[model samples]
Target: MSIPAEKVRERLHALRSRMEKKHIQTVILWDPDNQYYFSGFKAISYSRPIVYWIYEQQTAYIIPELEDLHAEENAYTDSFHVYHERYNKGSNDTSFLDPFIRLLQNLPSDTRIGVEYEVMPAYVYQAVLDHGHDVVDIGEDIIDLRSVKDEEEIKWLDEAGRLSDVALDASFRHLKTGMSELEFDSYGDQAFLQAASEKYPEVVVGYENWTCSGIRRSAMPHLHSSTRTFESGDPVVHSRQVWINGYRAENERTFLFKDQATEEQKKLLKLAVDAQQAGMQAVKPGVRACDVDLAAYEVIKEAGFEDYIDHRIGHGLGLSEHEEPYLRFDNERILKEGMVYTIEPGIYVPGVGGFRHSDTVIVTADGSRSITHYPRSYEEMLIE
Candidate 1:
């Protein structure tokens, strides 16, 4: 397991504290991240029940029978309740439900159970209700518990950030005018993976790449990479998240192909950079999360590009690129130490290209640290 045992214990301790505050006796966890968090069991959801059931005294993984041996080798928890068709060749519909019912019935009738209501499967919900166990929503609490990264998690995230910086440096070194969007993305991912293999043997990098060449196409956010070729004077909006171990760090930049950029393109890029800088400057231990967005958005407004802004400054990044406590004008969640997020303030003009740079940042007691650092100077961003 990538996470240390001490770190795992810390996570459990925090979870138990939260559970105690909410009177939650047992927790039914189905979210994969939570599964990985509680136990060192890692499994992709494939319609099979891969649950981590948390009782007052013990934690257990309920997985498919085929995965029983795998869980034994990899899972930190020794208590595993497995179910399979072969094991119950002639059993009826009760085959899958029986074990869960038995597990719940072992607890007292008044035991206050909590489930991730937003992500809990309907079958799981029915099983809890059928067993007469009191289930309450603990979705937000679970998410909040994961917002603060521990020392081990911060180590993995920092490594992920450096790997992402390696990827960005590779992409800029090889970027050219005639390459297709697919070609650029493919080459960039391969270079990142290769660099990670040589530099950090323990880390693996992967991402979903979004690339667009020319102003017309770059105006559309989340544009899928196609075979579109980059012209001589085109503006390239290239963005990707390089995931390490399961932690993600974003690396994105707006590039100009020719030696010279138009005045409007330069202005857009500077405005975006200034806005992003303002957002980065606002990150601290006690500042409101929305205030960071306002600090960035105000730059765009002052530059007369307020209407061009469509999305928030950024969102939380961890096992997933986008998560809780999103950096928008309405979210009032206060920033805290150990909370990692991105500060990407972009502007998309109607007939011009999108200009933005998204970087991974970790909030500290004083200010913040840019874990993923790449030179953002115009000289470093020119393709020619």
Candidate 2:
């Protein structure tokens, strides 16, 4: 189960308490992430919108009839309102509005429905308005609720971290001087899928793995895997996504060839690693997200290479690889316990190359704990 029954019940109770306090009659959840967060089921349909309705004391699902069986089998809901229609013989029918209308008509009109306005389609919004129902936009409220993870989410994230570590280890082991960039990424991709299978057995790895080598690698933050061969003196950057129980963890690393890093390269790597450490150390309850960015920025600036430091230190990692509570220089969101994010500080020198060190970290009541365990020191990257 993505989320156990007991945990789901607890979350439902909490949500109910909040709803009652706000006097919200019902919450119409359309965001897939929110759906997966509240219920453990992953919706498999893209043809129709997946809607979850949460009342003060009852939880229901408004899904396509085609997915009713799967939702019943996998998703935990107190009630189900399935919508489907049989097509006329030899009739061309591609729209799903009729069934959707039926589902909406069933909902109470006097109820103050809360919709995820940020993610709901304009047509859906118009439909809701046309139904003469009172609606409230609670998208930010939902995001705030999800920003602080529960104990069960933390447990799953910990497992995700371990799976990512295994994939990174496999990638590092396969890293050699003459391997093509695509070959290196292929090694990590295979390793990620194999490791995820051992844990989830049903999880599918995300789209494409990133692996870039040489000077051009510095330009692209999300480098696509390429067939270019790795040179003896080149720098390589790689990243991959691992999913376990529908939760995601992304990790990246930059490797310098053995005996090939110049004095400047070594110095820049040291500064970047030190800056990353400072940023990670700054994570704590009540600290602003930008404070963490400044912690690293101060370090890089003190080292007289502030201009070279580019990009935010890190971002929140959860169902989506990049989510809320971003760690950037201008973001003012305060950090809180149970919020997990990454601290990746890099120095990209145009002609030479770039160096970056990243790690996933969870803010604790006291300080923070780094879930990722890859070595960031220069000595750890020596090819032996």
Candidate 3:
């Protein structure tokens, strides 16, 4: 059940309405996530510099001429503007900016244009400014609209959640003691690809397991592919994902070795889990984002482990790993219906390692829904 193109158009129309309210005649989307959110086309080439322009009447795309046919075949834009160069007698011809300038000329002169300053390059900014048009920063305005998910987006997110669950289940079932951290990570990686292929053929997965054991586990956060091997009592952190129909859902869980966790270690893990639950329960429409952080902070504080809380309780999650409307102590943004975020509360002690339990959640009309369903209790930590 992929989202229909017409629904994407409707969402863009709504965005155009917002542009009109802001007195913006055009918007240039340069970020890959924003491009996918507006165009419904997922291509890794989007990681490079690209532009998606939306005018009052139509949508346009400026991409290398090499990608022209593919863009048209995918219906990436209503109109395509291509850029190419001609080779002559040992000298190259055609400036890259020529096509961009030509496209700019088609737009109305003196029109107030909006650009995503955060992602747009400095040269692009200069080129637009050189065109004698009124350019305004509209990055925040665009992000505000994107922070809240629509009905269609939530459906895709739900599908992504189900895919992640399948991946995690397979990975956990394959776990074994004495395996190197990379070995365990390979199992999870293969599991994600296998699950995504069965569920959504268009999906692509990224990120790797942050598996660590023994002394390395004591680090606050781990990264991909280390040489550490899993010992009997080593705490393990596995971060995995599933990209369903181009939508991403992430989940991280901590596992304790069988009969290996000390009483203190077990207690700390429980506190971290409880704090994560409190944060999730605090999600609701109209609540301040900071309040969600407080929910988890209060719990950890009462347990006399406030100092171990090193990061924000959670953050906004969507197409990209991190997005807007962050759930942090300093962020005063109000939570609204259709917003999706993660609630990950962690406690880290230098010699004892850390415990983190995270789940992606969506803000519903009445309250909220946890998109992730992987087991979260100590009893469920038993991999074998």
Best by TM-score: 1
> What are the per-residue Cα lDDT tens digits for candidate 3 across 119-161?
7889988999998999988888768878888777777788778
Q: Give the alpha carbon lDDT tens digit for every residue of 82-140 in model 1.
A: 77766454433224456677788888889888899888889779978887777899888
Instruction: Report RMSD (Å) for each prediction in the order shown.
Output: 2.5, 3.0, 2.9
The segments of candidate 3 whose C-alpha lies over 4 angstroms from its true place after superposition are: 1-3, 46-48, 85-96, 201-208, 258-260, 382-384
Show how many residue pairs clash in every candidate, following the order shown. 0, 0, 0
Clash pairs, candidate 2, are: none
Per-residue lDDT of model 2, residues 1-384, tens digit only: 667888777777777777777777788888887888888777766877678878767787777767877788778888866555555523332345554566678777787778888888999889988999888887777667778887877887787777778778877888887788878777666776777677666554453467778877844667677888887667677776666776666677777775776677667767877898899899999989999999999999999988887689988888877887789989999999999898888888887778777788889999999777867677775453
Ranking by TM-score: 1, 3, 2
Candidate 3 — number of clashing residue pairs? 0
Residue pairs clashing in model 1 are: none
lDDT of 2: 0.77
Write down the TM-score of every candidate: 0.91, 0.88, 0.90
